[model samples]
Target: MLSTRRRQFVNMLIFLLLILFILYSSILARFRTPEVALDSSSGSFLTKTYLGLENEQAQSELISGSSLHNEGQFVSGNPQSSLSSLSSSSNEPETINKVSTAGVPSDDVNNRNHISAEISSERSVLKSEKKNEVEEELHRILSISPVVIFSKTRCPFSVRAKNILLKKYSIDPAPHIVELDQHPLGSSLQKSLAALTGRSSVPNVFISGQSIGGCDEVIDLDQKNILATKIYELGKQSIKVQLRQTT
Candidate 1:
């Protein structure tokens, strides 16, 4: 039952109260309380104390510093002390004047030199003795044979040389024929004989304890007609001696 003008005035007052309420709420949301940080000097002091404790612990681990009666601890300042202690624990100390198992004095260089010289002289003597033994064996082989021929079974040159003595001269050189390829010691003996006689080739021909070269020399002597005369003289002497003994 309120008049129109009175109603309008009431509506305006209510609108104004609602706007003021919204403005107050927005301002309150924008304005925040400031956060306080810890003091820098206090934090730094705490950090230094922690680092000092850690350093003391490291020093104590590396070296035992103080007297047993006193509780005070000392820190090692030398950097090499830990390394030196590790090395000493690992290896036993050795003296420079220690002697060896061979009874040689390790302290003197002259003793080592003398031992080396003696070892070398012994090796030289052993080598010389071996050489002399080989020489004696070779000498025996050469001195026992008046005619020696080293040949191979399958070699054409060996067959040709044998044929010249047997068929042409009618001389049986079987006892003097050395088949080098068939014998076990033949190769080594042939090499030694060849080395001593200064003949580097094989199918060697030696007559009257002399090396007459190879097949070519024998063929040359046959072509010269001297081979037949020599064989005839050897055969005649043998036959004559045999006839006299039988009579």
Candidate 2:
């Protein structure tokens, strides 16, 4: 009987130990962290550098600045200009495109360039005096009228803009129309207009020598019923200026 009791106790202890071992293994598995092996060459998970974004230089500067800030050092002044600069830089391509397009007149303009602006002596300039004469002639032309339309006769947009201004609304001191396509210095003038107005297209309408933009802009103003009001208000201001000058 004593021998039987010893065997039974040994068996109970072994069973208990086996149960404990199983429980410990299961608990360990539930709490265990799996190791992940990242393969950079495979282009899978973990080490793609572009994940930081394409603006790596910007990011590095930001990180470096943050570190400097943490260290209580002078980082940078007016970082706000960074965004403004980026915006302006992004618009550079459009400005270049405008200059290029204005430098070369349209197909119709190439042939009609001998038609002349008011048939004035300023039609042609000597190469030696070209730049100064161009500026001076443009200034003279702008002062001829309170409202001016730099137009290309064959351009549909130009025609539309003229129709809107001439027929739809009655403007005082009648707009001076410079058929740019007919002018000798047309391309130069167009390019200058691009520089001045940020628009390379014809039908560049000006009030008091300020460009209001091309056809689409005119249409937008018309749609809003502000075109007449704008013209009248600008004309009124021009009159006031003249009166002030006379006084």
Candidate 3:
């Protein structure tokens, strides 16, 4: 009976040892390296996905950078076009000045030339009228007598010259004494005489509308005794002309 009891005890101890061994194996299998292998595979998949995403982002950044560069080129073209327009605008006035100088006369310049021509013509007309008036006056003075004397009232030389021609010679159709200082158109007549006969002094003596010069010349001619003979001959000629006109 004791031997059977010992065998039974041994069998019970072996069965208990087998149950503990089975329990330990099941616990170890529940937390094993297979799970670690699955985690490793999943981590590898995640790393590949991350790498792909980074590559795509880099490509997008490159594309965006290229687009920005193209946009910058487009933006820069606007300033060039504006500069071209400014250059064209600045050249417009220069072209206009060139055109004006070439042969297309400016209106203002033409107007100025026309005005200058008109002024010159007007001056010419006025000068011609003045000359005609002066000539008419000269003819009237000469027709007064054959012998004419231009004299000044205040000049002693003119008085002496008149005395020599009138009192000493006793000339017929006696010299017409003109007092220039007392006359209204005296200065004008003197200037005209200077222009016509080259004589402008007092006692400018004339015989038959011819200048004989001033006081000293007349006295000299009288002292030489030729003045009385010249006067008598001119007087006879004047009387003959008057008689012929009367007939």
Candidate 4:
């Protein structure tokens, strides 16, 4: 009966020991849970920080890309964006100067074209008016005297004609001589005279506002003795008109 009691006591002691061991294991598991949770929280914080850094880097890239676009450039995923930015900064002034210079030349060219157009218009107007001026002037000079001689002083034919009319002939009124070579509108006058009388030379002789001929005709008339008679008749007519005006 003692042996049986001792065996039951041993079994009871083993059961109590097992219970204490189980309580100790449960306490250790509870303590280790906090450390595991702290480790997990720390890992989560690290991941969040890494994600924040990535977000900041992405935002920075977007801002830089926008700024580059504003500067008149486009770069997508290019490694040389920094170099491109520096080059753009360096060339910005040159580009501005080129644009300004280009604009100024266009303005200058437009101004020059405007001035040229005005000058051309004025020249055309003057050309049209010159014909009338020459014609009117010729008529005025022709009416200055009854007998007119259109001549140049340097012309040999004119010198011969003047010697015959001025030195050899004597009349009541003198012949009005024009030195076309010394005249301001000499060339235009010569052209008009040629168109009117069909003669383009000096020593053109006119009688009573009518072109008789040139030096050859006058020499022929003087040699034929008809020049003196013609002069006397015209002189008498002019004197009679003057006398009537006076009366």
Candidate 5:
């Protein structure tokens, strides 16, 4: 009584329903089987074991033998046992504890050595800097003439020395009178002069490329009539004349 197309559509719907019923029955049958679940559990266990072995190999390659022991204990969920094993494998527990305590002294010694080395390196650098400064100062001092007197304005000894040089020899020690107290480079100049002369006294006197000592020393040399003679002799031995002739 139905047309051909309608008959075909009805048949197709029946086939689909039958297929779905078969799939539902198969699912129920699978759930009912305890053996199927056991098989799945076994497969999962095998996969986990295979992956665990690969991970173990990778870990072993990364960590050292002693460290591997700790890793294994951790992976096995027995940290207490791992630490106990590490301690027990060594000497007696008290001796092991003593050795651990003794490590502090060695660490202290190492730190001290490092500090000492740093101090030594700093000292070496300071020495080099001081040497360079001294050399530069010496070069500057020798290059000039006409009595370069490095003195402090506030110093009585410096004032006395300047008066004596001006009054006695008719020599105006100006234009070269480096008044240290008034100048910004006062402290540094004083320190350098002291270092060079090997004397901590003030009023460092230089006349014709020669160190004429402090105020008292200069006065004594002048009184003894040796100052003028020394100055004249130094003038003849002029560094400027020598350099000019060489050029």
Candidate 6:
């Protein structure tokens, strides 16, 4: 019976050891860290070297007061303008003065003056052409009537002259009156008339395309009794011309 007990105890110990081994293996499996797979894709040395060089260049350009932002390429010098150097040195007064004058040379100034004079001459020509057009229009109006008066509707002198010429005299074909105040080319006509007759004021009377002067002169001629004679003679002439045209 003692021998049988000893073998049974040995078998129990072996069974216990087998159970402990299984428990340890299960615990190790639960807490074990998994291994990760790594890729073999390291970049080449040349690419790393080029990236390092570009970073160094960008840093250098930033320190030199310039940047690669403008053209996406680094520039060598500071991005400041040379014009600001005008106030720097006292010995460069002539250069400073040149810069002060907008850096334009003396020859360029002379050329500009010449161009300005040419433009002034062109403007003068245009004015003269406009004046000629006004004169031609005035002449056309005068040709249609035996008598023409360059007068302003608002002028008392013009009213006075109209009254005398149209009311006092029994002239045929009443005088053609241009009320400059109401005309579109009124100011231009006045300028043309002044240039032609040398009489700048209104009430500029024209008899048979001839200037009979202003209101003062017309009244003077009437007081002398020659104004009526001149008007009737011109009226007779116009009547004869009309009669001939009809025939």
Name the candidate that leads on lDDT: 4
Model 4 lDDT tens row, 7-80: 99999999999999999988877865343445555677676666667767888887766564664766555568
Clashes per model (N, Cα, C within 3 A) = 0, 0, 0, 0, 0, 0
Model 1 Cα lDDT, one tens digit per residue, 85-165 = 557755966567766677766766566689899999999998777666666755565555445566788888777877776
Candidate 6: regions farther than 4 A off: 1-102, 105-118, 234-236, 239-247
Task: Please identify model 1 stretches exceeding 4 Å from their true place.
Answer: 1-145, 170-175, 224-247
Model 5 Cα shift for residue 117 (angstroms): 1.1
TM-score of each: 0.42, 0.45, 0.50, 0.48, 0.44, 0.49
lDDT of 4: 0.77
Q: Taking the tens digit of each residue's C-alpha lDDT, what string does model 6 give over 1-247?
A: 5699899999999999999999998997676322111111344566556666776787776677554546354444643543343235445535422422566776677779999999999999998898778878897889877888889878999999988877666556667889998988888888888888898899998878778799999899888878866765666655321111222
The digit string of per-residue lDDT tens for model 3 on 32-128 reads 4453444555667676666667767877765654453432332223457657766776686543233355466566566778999999999999988
lDDT of 3 at 75: 21
Error of 6 at 15 (Å): 98
Each model's lDDT: 0.62, 0.74, 0.74, 0.77, 0.67, 0.74
Compose the digit string of candidate 5's lDDT tens values, residues 1-247: 9999999999999999999999998998776434444455566767666666776776775464335343344222356865776677665544322323456555566678899999999999998887677667656754665577778888899899877665555443332677878756466667777776776667887766567788998789778877666655655634221111222
Count backbone overlaps in model 3: 0
Candidate 1's error at 175, in angstroms? Answer: 6.4
User: lDDT: which is higher, 5 or 6?
Assistant: 6
Per-residue lDDT, model 5, residue 8, is 100
Question: How far does residue 95 in candidate 1 sit from its true spot (Å)?
Answer: 14
lDDT tens digits by residue: candidate 2, 1-247: 5698899999999999999999998997776323211333465444344443434667777776555455344444347755675567668644322323456545435445645543444644455378777787789889999898999989999999988887777666788999998999888888888888899889899988888888998899999988877776877654322111122
lDDT of 6: 0.74
Off by over 4 Å in 4: 1-118, 231-236, 239-247
